[model samples]
Target: MNILDDLKLQYKLGGIALKMIYWNVACFLVSLVFFYSFKVGVFDFPSWIALSSEPAVFVLKPWTFLSYAFFHDGFLHLFFNMMVLNFSSYLFLTFFSSKQYLGLYILSAIFAGVIFVLGFNLMHYSGAIIGASAAIMAILVAVTTYSPLMNVRLLLVGNVKLWHVTAVILILDLMQFRLENSGGHISHLAGAFFGFVYIKLLQNGIDMSKILSIVLDFFTNIFKKPATPFKKVHKNYQKPAERPVSKIVVKDKKQQQIDEILDKISQSGYDSLSQEEKEFLFQAGK
Candidate 1:
């Protein structure tokens, strides 16, 4: 197959984070070609797709809030965002479904874009923005908040707590707030806030992932399902024989406790689990 076919196949097989990173990289390449050949800046490629910080322009084209997260101005801007996104995706998918991750990423990006525009307008700042930084930040912070004590080994830092890494990143964002690209920093924090809140609400038994489920359902239902054919039967047709229910259906208390511990490991990492719980899971897996 040709390169295009190979790319399509790769995209089909990859998870949400890889798909997102691929899209951003593709957009960047397309934008570069157009910039060199057509004299259009990265953010000025087309009004309907690229995002602008100007309130008047944004009011006219609201979809840019979501679209803007797919393009980057420079290589480093794209590289760092994609790296964090890859790491965050591995950690996030350990506990959450891919659908939930897609929802959180989209929701966080939209919220960050809108907040950036509003904040920029209020401060009379005149600058355009485009990148996946906000969404990447959200994923990183969200996973960290859920499992703060998780241990991660670094090349030079040995093993550090998850919360420690998150705190360092947050501090850098805060420190850069007054130095340069303050609006970008604000958008990052907005995404971070959304991530933290999304997980907290989930722990309370309120799932926000349903928002993306609705969106997916709408798109998938674009072609309606064929209706069932009408059936005809005799007036006194007898019903089919019923099957007996199984004697053992639901799991007992021990099984239930084991399932809970397993879920906890998925969320907070195995190290956060007690020794007893770890041994139980190990034995059960065997």
Candidate 2:
């Protein structure tokens, strides 16, 4: 297959993590066209799309809570966030389902956005934020909370406990809590907090992810088209005595043999097939 077809196939088969990466990358590319300012060399995201600290703007555009997580400020910002996202997704999916992974990502972003807005408003500050840092932190912290002692190998540090990595990140965020981009850091911590809470509640048999699923299903049903009812037909004409024979496809002997072998394999597995059958199937494949 060509490169585009290959990519389409990969996307169709890949898990939620890969799909999330694709979404983030696609959003970044679109942002570069409309949000990025060439003259100032910085992204100028609008209020409707980016998560704003002001209550007034957010109250009108509540969707920004989730939308902002997909856009990024710069190429480097997108690159680094995606890198960490892939790493965290790997660890998270090791112990969780893809549906949970997606639900956590979306819910965490919304939770973090809310916290960011609340914290900024309390401090009498105003600014907009974008990027998946908050969601990525949630995934990382969630997995680390569940498997603190899990071993993760770093590029130069070798193998280390998962909690060690999480702690370092948390400490850095805390140290810079009041420094540059405090709002961003606030959202990060909020997402981390949500992640921890999510695991705790899950241990108690409370699945927050199901909330998103229910909401989605409700909306889907609302928009879904109703099936048309079957109509009864009246008998208007008599049946013919002899109907013409429809065309029938006849397979060649080689193809017929291959089909038999495939059917056998499907029923009893490849190992159950005879040596002659295996060789015939292999040659047919080539």
- Position 142, candidate 2: lDDT: 96
Q: Tens digits of per-residue lDDT for model 1 on 86-199?
A: 888888888898888998999999999988988888988877677888888888888998998989876689999978888898899999998998878988999999899999
lDDT (Cα, 0-100) at 170 in candidate 1:
89
State TM-scores per candidate.
0.74, 0.80
The numbered model that scores best in TM-score is 2
Between which residue pairs do clashes occur in model 2? none
- RMSD per candidate (Å) reads 10.0, 7.8
Q: Where does the lowest 10-residue lDDT sum fall in candidate 2? A: 243-252
lDDT of model 2, residue 25: 92
Deviation of model 2 at 247, angstroms:
14
How big is the positional error of residue 82 in model 2, measured in Å on the Cα after superposition? 0.8
- On lDDT, the leading prediction is 2
